[model samples]
Target: MRLLLKNTKLLQTKEQLQTCDVLIENNRIIAIKTDVESTTADQIIDCRGNLLVPGFIDVHVHLREPGGEHKETIETGTKAAARGGFTTICAMPNTNPVPDSIDRVENLHEKITADAKVRVLPYASITTGLQGETLSPITELAKQNVFAFTDDGVGIQTADQMLSAMRLAAKAGKAIVAHCEDNSLLHGGVVHQGLASERLNLPGISSVTEAVQIARDVLLAEAANCRYHVCHVSTKESVRVIRDAKRAGIKVTAEVTPHHLLLNEEDIKDADANFKMNPPLRSEADQEALLEGLLDGTIDMIATDHAPHATEEKALGFLKAPFGIVGLETAFPLLYTNLVKTKKVSLRQLIDWLTIKPAEAFQLPYGTMEIGKLADLTLIDLNSSEKIDKQKFYSKGKNTPFEGWKVFGIPKLTVMEGKIVYNNL
Candidate 1:
């Protein structure tokens, strides 16, 4: 399968844009030039002056396949991801049975191959069954193609337990992704511990609940000499911790979500469950710090943290309801519309964060438009404008807070390995 994309503006790096024709043969990019005639391909796309980018890669996503299919499936979730311009998504291990063992990891691979339209990478659980007491088959799971290990829904509460796991992961050369929550400190709170919680008369999750874990995990990773990652970073204090860790030469990388960057406690009102999530959104000061963190390169990448819950589950008020929202379908538009189109960040810089930085962090070779690379690609319609329609979501979950967000710049087409997987047309 050979294909030619014409008049494409490709983002080569944070500060570079290379406009050319990207010729792909089978699954790898073969040529990038000014004028490639249509005779050398099976198909030729005009591109129509759209940006041709390496497909977006999200390091954090929840597919909910094994048991929570009522909320999401690899099939439905990846469809949403492809639509959001993502080519590869690293799935969380907090499934029903959990991908803790090698067999479970292998099962996820098989399921992804059979059901997913986009690439579905797995994260083996850091603790077996996520009980936080016993370690899963870390080395064996890593050998079986797990992108990283994470007990994402919760952290290993015991310092000793986490240290032991870190040692093993370090020895095995695996990336250990921390959910960074202090469970002992959590009293089943549903909002950030701040003025909002005080006003609403609700229990809240303290910023320290996430920050303390990050402080400890950074030192632990430094001690163990391992690649450590913090997921869904939401607080300014936490960002400061991560920045200090990076400056001191620890293998620490972190991700901030679009919602966290754009919305905060001020945006939540009247007990809306859509605004509720674990490590609940913080204040304006914290949100400003997050934007600063992203702009100055203190944060490594952007991820969706695309957790989805069923409607019945989310209807139980704010405190009793599950914490999450649908993210895959809305991430790109929200990020591009808010960050790039508004000039908060350069377009090239946004592309680099969405692709190259994630590729560099996970050691995945899928985020470049260079020749001989895999042809995972996203074509954007920079001028398209529409309101978000949650009623027609591909995933079973409609738990988004961004419903009717009048945003523009959506992925008009997404192609993986030279095959058109999603086309808005």
Candidate 2:
């Protein structure tokens, strides 16, 4: 099959918005030029001057397959990812019957190959069952197609265990994605330790819990020569720690969620569970620090941490609800509307953060639009505006705090491997 996409703007290049055409055949981009007539291709799409960028990649996402399918399955999750303009997403290991062994990861890989609408990379757990006790079969599972090793829901408590895992992961040539948190410091905290926590009378989760753990892991990663990545960073101190680690030549990378960047504790006006997440919304100062980090390259990329839970589970109010909200379908629009449109960052930089930066960090091959590369791309209408509606979401979980927010940069079409997987145009 052949597809020709015409009349679109390129995001990475400095070229002006023109009537460019991208030709694809046999799942690869064959040519990119201007004034290519539509009669030469099997199919042609008039992009209507939309921005044609490389398909987005999310390094942190929870597919909830193999056990928690009621919340999200591989098919539904990947479909949602495609709709959000993502061609590749790395699945976390915190599922029922955790992906801690070679057999488990193998099974998950088979499921992905059979059902995923886009590329689905799976992670193996650092600790068996995510219990933070004995180590899992990291060496064996890393030999498979696993993207990395992580215990995303729970942090590895013991330094020795984390160090050993880092050594093994380094030897296997795999990255160690960490969820930085100290359980002892949590103190049954449910929200960020700030003014909103005080106003809501909710237990507060201090920044020290996340910052201290990141500091420890950076030292261990440097000693072991491991590629370390911090997940869902939310605090000012954590950003400072990551920045210093990068300055000292430590191989550490960090990701921030859209919610953490756009919303703060001051935005939380109710006890709704949609506003809750593991690394809860922080103070205005923390939000400012995070934006600074993004502007200065202290934060590496933007990820959704696209966790989903059932309606009944999320309806349990803020204090007792689960620590997650659906993000895959909302990440790009929210970031583009709040960050790029507000002049805090440029459109090119935002595109790189979602595409090239993540691909560089994880060593993936699907973030560019060069010829001979996989034909994965997203066509976005940057001028149009839409009010977010949760009922129109493709994923099973519709828990989002930005439901009524007006946003720009809607994804009109998504192409994976030269095939049209989703078309909202």
Candidate 3:
């Protein structure tokens, strides 16, 4: 298949946004120029001077297949991702069989291959079944096609266990994407330990719970010399820890979710489960720190942590409901609307965070629009505005906190591997 994109504003660099035409042949970009004739390809798309950027890449997402299809599947989740302009996503290994063994990993790969509309890279658990007691076959699993190792949703509690896992991952040359949390500091908490939890009379999760574990992991990572990534960074103190580690030349990278970057604890208007998430919404001070972290390069990328759940599960209320909200369908719009449109960050910087930054962090090759690269790209309608309606979401999970929020930067078209997968123009 050959496709031509014309009259598009190509996002080339932080300061060089220029109009160009792109030609894709089969699965790679063949040419990029200021103008190309319409008869050069089988299909020609007039971008109408809209933004043409690399397809968004998410390093953290939860496609609840194998065990929890009630929430989401590879097919449904990737479809949602395509609508959000993402071409590649990484799946967490917290499924039915947990993907701790080679057979389980192979089984999950089969499902992804048969059902996924976009690229889905799966992670293997750092510990056996994410139990935190025994280490999974890290050396063996690293030989497989998994992107990295993580025990998301639950942090490895013991220092010795985590240290052993980090050493193994370092030896195998795979990243240890950690869900940093000190369970000992969590006293049956559900939300951030602040005014919101106090007013709602709910148990609160302290910032120390996340920061302490991150501090410990950074020290361990420096010693192990491993590629370490922090997931859903939420606290000011955690950001400080990561910033210091990077200055000290540690191989550390971190991601901040859109909700964490845009909403704070004060933004939680009521005791609703939609506003609840792990490393819960923090204070205004913490939100400011997150923004600074993102702008100054302490944070490496933006990940959706795209956890989804059934509506009834989330209807259980703030204290009793699970800790997550669907994000894959809303991340780009929210960031572009709040950050880029408001001038908090440049449009090129935002694109790098969603695309090249993640690709560089994970060592993946899908976030570039260069010639000879994979043709994964998206077109954006930056001038349009739309309210976020959950019913319009492609994923089965409609539990989002951003319902009814007006946002710009809507995705108009999505192409993966030189094939048009979605078109909203």
State the lDDT of candidate 3 residue by residue for 1-425, as single tens digits: 78999989886655566999999999999999998877888998889998899999999999989889999989999999999999999999988889999999998889999999899999999988788878999999998899999999998898888888889999998999999998889999999999899888899999999999999999999888889999999999999999999999999999999999999988888889999999799999999999999999999899999999999999999978998999988898899999987899998888899999999988897798899999999999888899999999999999899999999999989999998888887
Candidate 3: residue 199 Cα off by (Å):
0.8
- TM-score for each candidate, following the candidate numbering: 0.97, 0.98, 0.98
Q: How many backbone clashes does every candidate have?
A: 0, 0, 0
Tens digits of lDDT, candidate 2, 33-132? 9877787799988999999999999999999998999999999999999999999999998898999887888888899999999988999999999999
lDDT for 386 (candidate 3): 94
List ranges where model 3 is wrong by over 4 Å: 12-17
lDDT of each: 0.88, 0.92, 0.92
Per-prediction CA RMSD (Å)? 1.5, 1.0, 1.1
Candidate 2 versus the native: TM-score?
Answer: 0.98
- Report the Cα lDDT for candidate 1: 0.88
Q: Where does candidate 1 stray beyond 4 Å?
A: 12-19
